[model samples]
Target chain A: MEKAIEVKDLRKSFKSAAVLKGVDFEVKRGEIFALLGSNGAGKTTIVKILATLLKPDGGTATVNGFDVAAHSENVRQSISLTGQFAAVDEILTGRENLIMIAKLRHLKNPRQVAADLLKRFGLVDAADRRASTYSGGMRRRLDIAMSLIGKPQLIFLDEPTTGLDPEARIEVWNVVKELANSGTTVFLTTQYLEEAEQLADQIAILHEGRIIVSGTLEELKKLFPPAKVEYVEKQPSLEELFLALIGKKEEK
Target chain B: METTKKHFLSDIGVMLGRSMRHITRSMDTIITVCITPIAMMLLFVYVLGGAIQAGTDNYVNYLLPGILLMAIASGIAYTAFRLFMDMQSGIFERFHSMPIARSAVLWGHVLTSLVSNAISVIVIILVALIMGFRSSAGIVSWLAVAGILALVTLALTWIAVIPGLTAKSIDGASAFSYPLIFLPFISSAFVPTDSMPTVVRAFAENQPVTSIVDAIRALLSNQPVGSEIWIALAWCLGILIVAYLLAMLVYKRKAL
Candidate 1:
């Protein structure tokens, strides 16, 4: 079978400045492939190309058998994108926002689909509430839920968990994993190294618009072996120790 | 084509609801659009009406149609501004990723502008009626006025969407609309084109504002409209088609 996503020598630039320089990568079907990069490393630019939002200055990409440039509408039909922020409309209710995307996608039974997604995202209780009123986690959930309206084969998540508590972030991780397990190819770009380690079946480190490294977790770990895994080795973690010392002194 | 049409109609209905919700939520914007034109009509009719040399009819009657068009022109900008906001917010990018129709987004915004402009026009007309502005035309004539206003709004809305998609700043998005707001002043909307210089008369008569206002004015007055109505519809339809094509072109080039 052909790769779910294929890119070769993809170069993107904003006028004089190049953002993505001859980047080559491919994502296997049903695999969670994470593109790790720092800010301005062209992570989002690559995601945009794959999602059919931005055209590369040079090189070409294909998503789910459709060329990103020549067959954009076809590529668009098979992929969904969730941007860095939870870009839901503030004035629209959670359900309205979902339904808007559903209707735009020409979904059959939009209301039912919206309800299912809402329930699936655990947002049914807040479905009627304006998305603005939602907590950060709820909004992000709704954002991801909106992307599923098309039943897309590939999902480009550009920083899916930028501003979430640890617990909420883990929930998103589970969701991404679940999507990959269910045969959806998840192409993710994230700043969090741990997130890549946790979720990615395959990984590529994009630095300065080039893929400096590409491998699995074990493969990546081999390059910088024994990079100081620091631990406190504390006497009862200090906080607990201090608390017990103070309590004993008080009792004495 | 059939699927596209189905998607378009569905998008229009859904977008019309969303746009109406936006207006209803902020209602102050619609009220401002509705009341500003009528207020100007009131001020012009009562304060400046006596000095104006529009025609033999009540000055209110002569100026009412212009104010109606102005109301629509002003109201339609908000639609563009709203579209701009959505574009900036990454909503269009989100829409593009879905499997639905591509043109639905633009149509949604265009139809919303038409609906809200309709409300603003009705409000202005109600105020005009209260202030002794009369129209003797029947339903067909009224429908003609509606058609003219809808086409005008559609054209202006498309024009507005261009900046909304391309502008770097919020104020920049709506800034382009200022020239549109000022257009009616130079045309026959406010004064008789015959009174202007020869050059200005040619411009004012040929530009869309004059023809549209004149067609609407003639329709409301129950006068034989002659070819002016055709010219007006042609201008409105022509501008609508051109602006729409240009906007979609520019919008396609724009990055989210």
Candidate 2:
């Protein structure tokens, strides 16, 4: 498979403090590749470099066959980034936000693209509401929808579900999985182990500005001693109960 | 290259649209812009105008030009405020990742500042007119007033961009404008520089605001503009070029 992203000995520093120290990784095309890291592990720095938002102090990175530093404009044209923050313009309505991105991308029909994305993201009902009034889940959905404006072949999602409740997190996960299913490569950073296990086709754990280990889920699982599996009657998880109660309350 | 130019223009338009939307949504900025300068005008014309002799019989007309400058100075603080807000949010990073022309982002804020400041000036002018501010100058002189105000706004807005990018707090971002607001007082805006002490008079007579104020005052009264217009233009252009370069440099460093 073609590689979507390639990083070699990536190094970045903020003043005297080095953030990424000789980190290296690769993400394949059309796969969900998760980078697991703790806070200050330099996941954001890596994402910023690959997205051409920041230049690496040392080493090299390429995205979609374009050198991030040398052909940054070309790389930028092929990728979209959903930053840690929502990054949506709060004063604008959801529809206006999407239209703004589409227009910025120089699409021929910004209005139609915005309308279609709003419907696809199940945000049509809230499309005219200002983004500042949106629920956290709605804002995240709008953010992802905005990123897909130009139908970029590669996407960088930096901590896509950091503060979300389970239902909202799953909603974002579904959107991410759909992107990969449609053959768009996804590079995401996360702090949740289950998130990596559930969605990623491959995972790399980043520790202290370096990828400690990387492999497919099953391949990494083999490194640990196996325990006997047992089946029991499953109960509704607390998350599920919480979501159900919230849904009912809103309905009433 | 042709398509790139086209893309740059379109991207600026789109970003300008976003900034304009924000301006319309926030009513507080509009109120603040109108109230501050008009209040200063009313206070000086009623209370202080009687005591301070500024060579003109109608203090409102003499004070109107400088108050317009003050209004613009105050209005541009909002530009820094908005730019600081955009910087704090990750939108700057998102824009950095986009393929659009890099300068378009700054231009959007700059253009929005020009538009909003122009509106604030117009509102202040209308209030001045209501309070007996009049001028005998023809179409060309009126155009000159607009032109000079536009240049002043352009110059100061670029200066505002510097703090907006580098400031750690909102107060820090906006504090730069206080000096700008105070500049008119030290110059010939309220009282003539001749009435001041020697050192104070020297500074007031040589500063940028005095020339701008004198030029506008001359144009309003149909007096010969003479060299004050040239000096005012020189000051505005010099500050504009320097501030533009410094702001862009700071912006590039912060983006990293």
Candidate 3:
């Protein structure tokens, strides 16, 4: 089968600044491929190019077997983008936002599609409420639900949980995992190492516009010097501590 | 090509429906757009009307056209503000990445501006009627006024798209309309240009707003609309073409 995404020496620049320089990567179908990088590492530039929202300055990128540059409409037809910020329309009710996307995608029975997504995403109770009143987690879920309206072959989530609370971040993680389980290829970018470790089937670390390393979690782990066995107490991470406290509070 | 064209219009309709919902849900935007122009009409007719000589019996009659133009100017600022919000919120990017026609996203906002501005114009006209403004014009003339107002709204909305697409801040997005809102004041919208000094009068007579205001005022009064209507159309079409080109250019560069 053809790959979900393919890139070869993709290059892009803004003004005189080179944001993406000779980048290369491939994503297999039905897997969560996480592109890990710090801010300004060109992860977003690559995603934008593949999503057909931008034109590459040089080289080539293909999404779902269509050239992103030459066949941008076909590329768009195969992919959906959930940008860094939750793209839900604040003034629109969550249901309306989903329906709007369905209509734009030329789906039949938009209302039914919206209703089904609302139930699946656990947003039925908030369906009629304006998205402005939603919490961060609810808004992100709504954004993801909107993106799923047309059921594109691939989805690009750029920094999906950058500013989310720990619980919201976990909620997004579960949603991503659920997407992969259902056989959708997900291309995601993040600065969180734990995010890549937890959800990615394949991981690529982007450093200064170049992929320095690409592998599965275990493969990347082998790149580090062999670990000498040591007996040390492990402290709970802040995320674990926060979740525990929140879980206790909820139980009460 | 056939399917693409069909999707282009349908996609614009869908996008327009979305923004129209925004306009309807927040009726306050419509009221806010009307308040300034309506308030100016009230202030001028009641307080300043006795002193100002606009060569008309009812000051509101002389003032209605300019007020309509001003309302449209203020109304399109909301278009800019909404577009800026979309750009900031990433919804714009989401739409761009979709398979729908790329230009539909913009046409949606532009059409919304026209409809919302039309609503504001009608409301102000009702207020003018209540303020003792009357017109002798028949139905054809009334339709002409509607057509001109629609054209003016389309032109200004396209101009608003420029700042909407490129503004660095919310303030910058809407600030472009301030001068537009103030433009009618210096034209024949307020008082007759015959009473003014040369330089200001020269500007008042030569500017686009004056011809538009004069043409609308003539149509409403059932007077001869000779060259003024043509000049107004020329101005509107000229601005519409130039603004449409520039806005599309900006959108292409920004999106790509």
Candidate 4:
């Protein structure tokens, strides 16, 4: 099968400042491909181009077998985008937000689709409440649920867990994992190394508008210095510590 | 192409429904928009009515047109603010990336402004009636006045969209309306343009608001609406077309 996404010498600029300078990358179908980058690294620029929200100055990109520039409508039909901030309508109830997206996608039964997603995402209890009252985790889950309404072949998640709590981050991670398991390709951008390490089947580091390194976790690890044979007490990560604290407090 | 056009109307309907819900839930916006204009009407009619020589028996009758215009001017500020919020919250990007008719997103806001402003105009007119304002105009004249108000709303709402798409700050987004809200004061809305100094009179007579207010005033009192109606329509349609073209250009360039 053809690649889910292919970019060749993609270039873009704002006024005189060059962003995404001749970048090249490819993503296989049904895999989690993480574009790792820090702030102002043109990660969003790349995603916007692929999603057909922005026009590129040079090069070509094909998303889901259609040129992003020439056949944007086809590419749009094949993909959904979850932006950096949770894009829920604060005034609408959680169910309404999903139904709104479902209707926009021309779904047959918008209310039923919203109900099913609400139940699946554990948001059924909060479905009637305005999204403004939702916690950060819940809102992000709702945003992801909205994106999944049309069941696009591909999804672009930009900084999906930037400000999320550890539990919420894990929740988003599980959702992404579930998406890939269902054979939907995911293209995600993030500044977190651990997020890329935790969820990505393929990781590509974007630096200075180009991909500096691209490989699997194992292949990329080989480029580092060999690990020394030493024994030390293993420390739990902050995520583990926080979860443990919360578990103890709840039990008490 | 056929399918895209088919989806456009339905897409606008969906977007419009979403925005109308925002308006209905936030009743404060409509109330806030109506409050200032109504207060101004009361102030002008009760306190300043005897002094100003507007050459009309009931000051409320003369002031209603201007008050309605002011209410619409303020009402559309919410349109800019809502669009700005969407841009900041990333919802704008999500919508843009979807496979829907893109311009429908904006038409939704524009049409919502028309409806919300219409509601404000109707409320203000009801308040004017309670204050003893009356009109000899029949149904056709009423519709003509409604048509003018709708045109004004469309023209101003398109102007609002420009700032909505391009403003860097929330304050900047809504601030454009302050001048618009105050524009009626300098026109023939409050008093006859002949009462002003020569330069001010020249401006009052020439500005779009003057023609609009005069046309509305004539239509309300069942006076012969001569050239004022044409001039008013010209101003509104001119502004509408220019503002719409400019707004679409900004939207295309901003790529939001």
The lDDT, on a scale of 0 to 1, for candidate 3 is 0.93
Candidate 1, position B160, lDDT: 84
The docking category that best describes candidate 1 is acceptable
Q: Which residue pairs clash in candidate 4?
A: none
- Chain B, candidate 4: TM-score: 0.98
lDDT of 4 at A108: 98
Q: Judge candidate 4 at residue A129 and give its lDDT.
A: 99
Candidate 2, what DockQ? Answer: 0.75
Those runs of model 2 whose alpha carbons end farther than 4 Å from true positions after fitting are A228-237, A243-252, B1-3
lDDT tens digits, residue span A26-62, model 4 = 9999999999998999999999999998999999999
Name the candidate, 1 or 2, with the larger DockQ value: 2
Off by over 4 Å in 4: A248-252
lDDT of 3 at B50: 96
DockQ of 4: 0.74
Q: What is the TM-score of chain B in candidate 1?
A: 0.92
lDDT of 3 by residue, B25-90 (tens): 999999999999999999999999999987778789999999999999999999999999999999
Fnat of every candidate, listed in order: 0.56, 0.81, 0.85, 0.77
TM-score of predicted chain A against the true chain A, for each candidate: 0.88, 0.93, 0.97, 0.97
Between the candidate structures 3 and 4, which one is better when assessed by DockQ?
3
Q: Model 3, residue B75: what's the lDDT?
A: 97
Measured with C-alpha atoms, the lDDT of residue A135 in candidate 3 is: 95
Q: What overall lDDT goes with each candidate model? A: 0.83, 0.91, 0.93, 0.94
